[model samples]
Target: MLGQKNPPVDRGQATAIIVFILGLGALLPWNFFVTASLYFKERLAVNVAVNMTLNMVVNGTHAGHTKDYNFDSWMAFLSMLPLLLFTLLNSFLYQWVRERVRVAFSMVAILLLFSLTAALVRVQMEPDTFFSITMATIWFINTFSAVLQGSLFGMVGLLPSRYSTLFMSGQGLAGIFAAVAMLISVLSNADGINAALGYFITPCVAMVAILACYTLLPHLEFARFYLNRDETDKQPIEKMPIKSRDKTVLKNSEDPKDPEAPVLQDYKLPEKHTHNQPRLSVFAVFKKIWVMAACITCIFGVTLAVFPVITVKVQTSYRGYTRWDKVFTCVCCFIMFNSMDLVGRSVPSLVQWPRKESRLFPVVVVSRVLFIPLLMMCNIPDSKLGTIFSHDFAFVVIMALFAFSNGYFASLCMAYAPQLVRSRDCETAGALMTFFLALGLSLGASISFLFGYLV
Candidate 1:
């Protein structure tokens, strides 16, 4: 039976855990930025005058300023540039090397950089250091993480659909974990230094754990099974040993001590089948999944354009909710979105609707652009015009829907992409898909800046 050569189904649970962890680690850098959002608003000066004053009298524009400068949208936009550029570069290089190599390299770089950055932040407690220095560190960490995520998701695409689903769910989990931590910090009335330390401690611990997982992954029986499948697919028939009447002679040839291999009786090399199943070119894979890629790009782009920047800025006009406003706007929204997103991603494991080959996926994705207007109409600050969906409840509901759709559509696109091409080119299809994801994030981040001004 063909079942003899198939991977054991029992290994699914272990593989799922590994893929989930991989997804978690890949998105941790971004999570670090989001979770530490409060620190940025507090420590980094946005106003030129405040920066000058801090620089001359205190540590140059590095200390916490009294005046708050709305830098979220601009920070989102600026942050994506390096990530977008490096994702493309990594995607291009994927055509030449294995995804594991790139993933490993990026992971090591991430660990070292984060360790170094955390140490610098700890030692240089003076608020006077250049904000540019901090921004530079953030940018580089994001850039490397972009490459790491592209490679990791691409690798996941080569596996079963459930792996990619779990991977996405893990990303949502990171957001949930972060949101909960921030909420706890707020409730406990932690000082600024203690709060910042919380953010630093979480990643340092997570990164170390992730590094151990990566090291052990290759040795896991579950991981090895999929890797073996990949190797089998790439090896030609001619390279395999031919059946022989003199099994002893063939066995002798395989022995490392036998410098001169013995000729086996009634053995002949297998014929190569090059005419069938040629590898798909990168562009060909792109064309096959361009619509899917577009859906991913648009989904992320629309999300990046609004979230935390525009959506997080909107709060109730009530006076009593002032103390909890930041918590409600930033932390609660993130938790709601992340929870809904986890549900959305998990749904595909049970039901893969609107098949990847169907035209409906892209249509559904494009329709999401409508959320842009809907979100903008919420109770935003300084708006003279009244909105029908002005209430906080309505905003939370919309955010839930927005996040759910994002997870569902993104998971579908990624899981479906590799299926469109030959097994050998699945990774390429994945890398191409990751490229579009970055493109979407970049587009959305850029659009966020404009929306910030408008809001």
Candidate 2:
């Protein structure tokens, strides 16, 4: 990590560099899953009631199966284990693979797992139950994809901090493209089984192809230009004796307005501090900021929980909405959410929010409290708000707000993680974040099933 420091790069150069590093299509696959989920629900009408019922039964069989048993609660309870395990595994493996290899492997892994799960559920379930299992399977794939994306973010952050700005720009562009793709897919004459496969398969394959090409592109290492303080300060300083008044007078008289005066001014630089220490270890880093990590993890759980449910809500409440409308709504919401998220990522650089040690806890607590009301609003009776807003529009607005909150929280969490941990520990911290994300998603899906049954 030791290197000579160069002058800071301009914003244009930084953005270009991040795009070059993260690749243009890095996020395409991530967005593909989002689009595919919407496409299936709208086009195929894949109901998940059977899968939820099965999971509930599985949970109940393990218990006494008493008359007092609550199946919804049981499903939520049983889902925690896989979610936790997947998260832990994701965190541990995030650092194990090389960056380029990790991207390829993760894409293939998700595609394969998703395809297998979808095919299996399609074959096994009756027509009524197919959608439900398919959705559940999508949840599993989503958790996997999230872990991979978090690792990518962590690795990009490791690039000299200057490159962070570039990462955001690239993310923004990718999000825009994803939104456009979703819109196109919805407008096209795609529906039923063929449409579902087309929406899901085509983009994923395209993304894999694009990413493979990226692997062959040469990597640019900009870190070489920057000089460390130790390297710069090692130059010896020469001792200069004070001149007597006569000598100073004679020199000044002879060299008044000398051309070298500007050189002398440049030479009078401030003393540089030298501390050639290794980056902190993972444990040391976590010890300093575990609370923030825990809070972010919980928020991630909540966000993941809410997203899939939005699709469900639309399907349930606005049955009359055209397939295109449903797909368009989901895609537009995703784009809007990601676009806002990209903005939030850049906010810390533009403005200063409260940054005191004690302030963080309160800020996070307030954010969590805000989330509760927003979530409750989503569940409010459509009849009550029918006068003010259509159920569909209200759902979309609530989801957009949810996305906005998620983006803000995610940006803050990324910013805080590095400050709390050591440079080397970034990968580990990232993995832990992903673990929490997966745990949250699994729990969220289980919760959705339980709630669906209860309602």
Candidate 3:
């Protein structure tokens, strides 16, 4: 009977659920990418410098006495673009495609394109041409990575309500595993700095492997489960009114000045039900999403804008600290912030004073405002406590608070999104959220670059 309200249990939903779980497993390897980049920063710099010089020579420009470009810094910034682009593209595709086979094919095609591009650059570039080649390679790899990441996440969004448990459990497990790996990395090494730095690649590789495994799962299952197969197999569900007294009233009420309304009015009804029609225009859905995306982007932008400066402040202001101490501080900060985020997301009712959707807007605005003051505090010259706290503790506290606020705000936003549209439009809503997330990151990074120049 419930299947009458919502579509039946299907293989597509089952597959999506499985994929979502595997995607969570992928998180375990996140550290690998981070650590790999950090471990090879010096080498990357040397390669980039050599490549830049060679390119300058080949292009008939002066190669002598070039100011060193920090490859690590540039790579960090450049890497984000691929992910952002993929996310934006994925959002569009998720709405357009109906079949899981089509979705998977599109995903693979994009990934292959990125991989091939990277491979071409890698094979063609000489050691002296490393900087440009490395940047190109990183972009290609990132594009492929982003596709993988986006597809996995997108699959989760496609899961049927009944199988949502599988996705959530997978994500929860992934978080736990990530925390455990970090803990192990921290404890195993005599010098926590090396451990922390060295362990980044593990998480990224794990993510890739897990995602790859998930990629091979049954695509048809997801299509059948997530989508209304009967509707999809036919000409789509008809937007017919429910056989209820309320529907009759709704139909009659459409003609505001109708004489027949008097006859229907005399027959009082105790209860009524109306069938809600869904919007079919993809453009209209996308436009609605754009507004929410813009808001989220602005919020995220304000938060991320200061990240680069924060790291610099930590290094310079807390100069006297040991390497291990610095690592410890960073790890502690990450833990605190993520912990708060987890708590807020998991137990939103505990923190939300007034649990309403509108509350999110104010929360986001206030969080952004808080960042400005917190950032300014870092620049205080005389107050050792302020400086020390800013360097070691302030970021953690600010990020934690930001995370908490964002969690509550996101949950509220998600809850409110469906009400703004029809039931079928939830996927589009998710896509919009991701679109804004990418936009926010890109904007924040760019703004950070500008701020770096000014400061």
Candidate 4:
């Protein structure tokens, strides 16, 4: 018995893996939407007359008076507004709808919306109609995804701190996966519409997996243990009626149930007493985390402003193999940012510098503003500002650093937030952080329009 091993908890990190996948599912739809920017542009750029002409033959030209559909501007405005509204609304909606119902319903809504999105790929409509429908669909999709995302973060916060990190890392992976999916979607078929038909289905598959993971999460021993502990943590110490104040304590006592796992004490409930930390008001929780929330908000805000909207327009003048020129945006910008972002998100698990409480953390986040101009000065075609970082290499390098910092600081803020508050307020803080992130996204997305114009 001297060296018997304890039974494993989260053996092989199965729970961790599930948590990661759940995180992946949480943001997969948004990633897919971001990655498929070109596809949407292609579909919406043409008028009904052009679309019909293309169907009769194989292709059409941009020669005629085309609809002035600014897809990027519309997309930026539509997607995040509902997302912002719904994310905040979820905190209140939790009163009427249970969290599980909200999550399950949100996933189902996204599935249906994407199904509609996929179905539209083959059918050509007037640019006006298509744009309207697309914008409405995006609004609804973000509406639901906001609920799912905010709720998932709150749920993950109830678990160990590491799970929160895993969850964030999973979202980072979602971006990477979407980027790869973009590559495949663009390359597999010459026809953009057909490629998108397949492209939209991937998230449907990811949704099934996400829903399954959510269902399986409650069944996991490790997840349940911490979840139960969180509930106990929330209960006021006074609520547990103390049978007696006199308590017997045992030290170094082995839980006979698990001989190798040492139990620090086998003790009775102490007399009811107030914990030193009081329950925080919602505003108080926000006050504790506002700095990080703002950091994360601004971080996302800045990233979105310059990313696909402007970065997608960046052209690399470096003479490449001719074929590489065609897919430059897909490779250099989308995939590059995402892969670097995933790397940045993962780094916190190893080295999270600029401790959350440090003055230096926000300073670093604020400094990322330079990226907006650095990216603007890249090889964007027809820019008010001419390209200085004209080569693909320069643009790629700037974007990599920009994206890495976005993931690194943002993850630190998210992971640090729940820790900075009372246990009962951890989930609340997580939800509030989700709202700020949306706030940042909404603001960044709006500003991105201006950035897009400046470029």
Candidate 5:
């Protein structure tokens, strides 16, 4: 009778919420780091005020983060390089470290870095020295953040696709959260040091709570059933063919200190195989999901090539008509895009058009490439062809479309990837998918400069 019982229900969508929180925590630290652009600019250019003006005057270049020792150069290149490097490296990290180690160690390390970041907020140092320490911190933060992201993606793949969608949606929400926090600080006019302290503190406190939520995750039978579903079928464990492997491996691997929490099952291999499932290599998993992988790569590659870099340049035509020019880029480019992107990611829960198996899925992903040219021809002054989309409404409409496409297609790619392979291969497929996603980021960033020249 017990063997025939259905899998436990995920009462109240508790598991989904945990996955969303973890996803939010994974990117929350980095979002804070990037959002404080003004504070970093002020810190990096503390003593170079006269020199900065003189340089801009002499060179006749725009006074922006490019010329200043701000985040543009250091963070754009240095931060992303390590993020790409370690994200690809983390694809193989499972061979050496346990899943819990990868997840826990990463969160703890990032939490410490967030603490260090908060402490450094009030400390005054020469800009060069401060920049050096800050760069080092950024590298380590990306390194660990990438690992946590891959681990969580792989774990989420064990469940259903909606969970993956929720996780990606959580990431979209993280960007909005960072933007709201930044807007608050900007509007408040708090001193840079105090504002930055507040920024760093938010992620640190949030991480602790998220970590506690993860610790409690395994104890829930709802989560346990999905996590080990392949093993815990309607059939009994004794009926499965146990060849040479020790049966003790099948014993409940719950944590001892907290005996109720089933922490180890997510990382455990089956004690024996029923059908002798072939162990799939990373490349094998990639092969099975290559279409989805390529679609996502192209989708994000096209997205990053234009967003912020090109979008920021497409300013309002009504420059002096109601102060819209001043806040146009901030509100239109960043806020509008993120807000709509959040909506796009969430919409999949209700309506996932272009089903994962349909040929139209890849077609839709490929079609996003057109947004690059559309955005390039917008109200950008530097465009030799001149602006085709002139009005503020035109720019806003295009940005909403662009942002929605990015969130929707990217979530679909993630949800579809792990399902392309067998049950045992889902985790590997998901990890490899993360690597390809990182690769797309690098590819798009590299080409962004080229696109800027075109505009």
Candidate 6:
């Protein structure tokens, strides 16, 4: 009773926190960019400097003066470019680097640097240069961030399936948080520069938090239990008593009576390998889940091609809500899409709709491609295309479907892929899925450029 030692930290809760942080950090930048679309457009939209004065300076024509530059033209491509290219490259990059923690730290540093640079651009750069600079920063930041995302997904796949689910749900939270922030800023009529500064500052703080959580994970007792299991498996069975090894089996605090090691529910570690055997090829794993890969690719491709690029531009035809009208439309749509997407991602845990192996999965994926054209038809300014679903309420209905389908299908694809292959290759399968996810984003972003021109 003289001196008492401190209680041990809870590894289970710590691991959960880290997983949530990883998921949230991975998508925070994206949420901010999409949620803040209206703010960026207002500040960076092409100036109304139509010419004719002093040999084509300021314009006399009201029509010319009213026209704004098509600001969405370049950003649609830049936003998704890195996700596509770097995700493919990261497959090899991850293999080359043995220490994931180091890479995770590096990613945090890069995100912080980019966020700082974004703030600087707003302060130091001229208005004319804002669009180009902002686009370039987005491209660079996303390119590196994709690596971080791929790494996070791989790590999650290596853990229990619930961890992956937790990660995805965290992404939904990021969107909701962003939507709320933007809504507040717009309604409060917050200073444009101050609001933009908050946009950049928020992610930097999150990356720092993510880095801190990652640093704590390796040292936790519960985490070490899993790592120790991996170590015990590598030891020669002849040297280690089977009973002795069983004694070390990890037990969760919630299930103290259970003696089993905490391994992934869907995947089991392979039996001990003989010295003569070679390891499984990454392609071998990919071959098993090619259908899943295709499904995920098409899912993200269709989503990235249209989302903030096209959806954000779909203005409300309603005259009732005119004050901060663009901001209202953008924030409302973002919150609706994000909230529904969260529901979609979470649904797989309760029910896996359309079994992973079903032929209907691909059919479902291809059907989603129609959302792009359908969303495009909604109240896009200056487009020759006749508007049909012009009301904000109608657009809201379609967008909810669009976001829900994307989150549900993408989550299902990821969760099911690990189950398709051998247990050891689950990580590889997850990484490969991430590659396709990036590919889809890239493909969609590229298509968004064409849509931009047409609009």
Candidate 1, residues 1-455, lDDT tens digits: the string is: 01123233424366678788888888888877766766666665433455566687875445444644454544565578877887777767876877677777887877776776566544544333535556677788888888888888777765656778888888877777777777777777767666677667777788778777767777766556554535655332112224532344344344434433322221223234532566677778888888888888998998888876777767765548777665776554778888888788778888988988677767888899888888888887675444668778888889989989988888888888876665567677877887888899888887787887777
Q: List CA RMSD, all candidates.
A: 8.9, 10.7, 10.2, 6.1, 7.6, 6.7
How many pairs of residues collide in each model? 4, 9, 21, 0, 0, 1
Tell me each candidate's TM-score. 0.82, 0.60, 0.62, 0.85, 0.85, 0.79
Candidate 5 wrongly placed segments (more than 4 Å): 1-4, 49-70, 233-275, 321-323
Instruction: Work out how many backbone clashes candidate 2 has.
Output: 9
Question: Which of the predicted structures, 2 or 6, would earn the higher TM-score when compared with the native?
Answer: 6
Winner on lDDT (3 vs 4): 4
**What value does the lDDT take at residue 109 in candidate 4?**
89
Candidate 2 differs from the real structure by a C-alpha RMSD in angstroms, to one decimal, of 10.7
With a 3 Å backbone cut-off (N, CA, C), the pairs that clash in candidate 5 are none
lDDT of 2: 0.49
Decreasing TM-score order of the candidates: 4, 5, 1, 6, 3, 2
Candidate 3 deviant stretches above 4 angstroms: 1-35, 46-67, 94-129, 145-155, 158-209, 212-279, 315-324, 348-366, 379-395, 411-419, 453-455
Candidate 4, 1-455: lDDT as tens digits: 11212122676677889989988888887888866777778666655557757765765444455556777667777888888998887666655777788889998989899899988888867788888898888888988889998888878776656678888889989988888887786667567766788888888888888888888878887666555533454333111112431222222233547745522221123224424455577788888988988898999999888877888888768656676887788899988888888888888878878987689988989999999999999988789998798887899899899989988888888888887765556667878889999999888887887887787
User: In angstroms, how far off is 196's CA in candidate 5?
Assistant: 1.9
Give the per-residue lDDT digits (tens) of candidate 5, residues 210-252: 8898888888877777667456632322211224323354343
lDDT, residue 197, candidate 5:
91
Q: Lowest-lDDT window of 10 residues in candidate 2? A: 262-271
Tell me the lDDT of model 1 at 8. 30
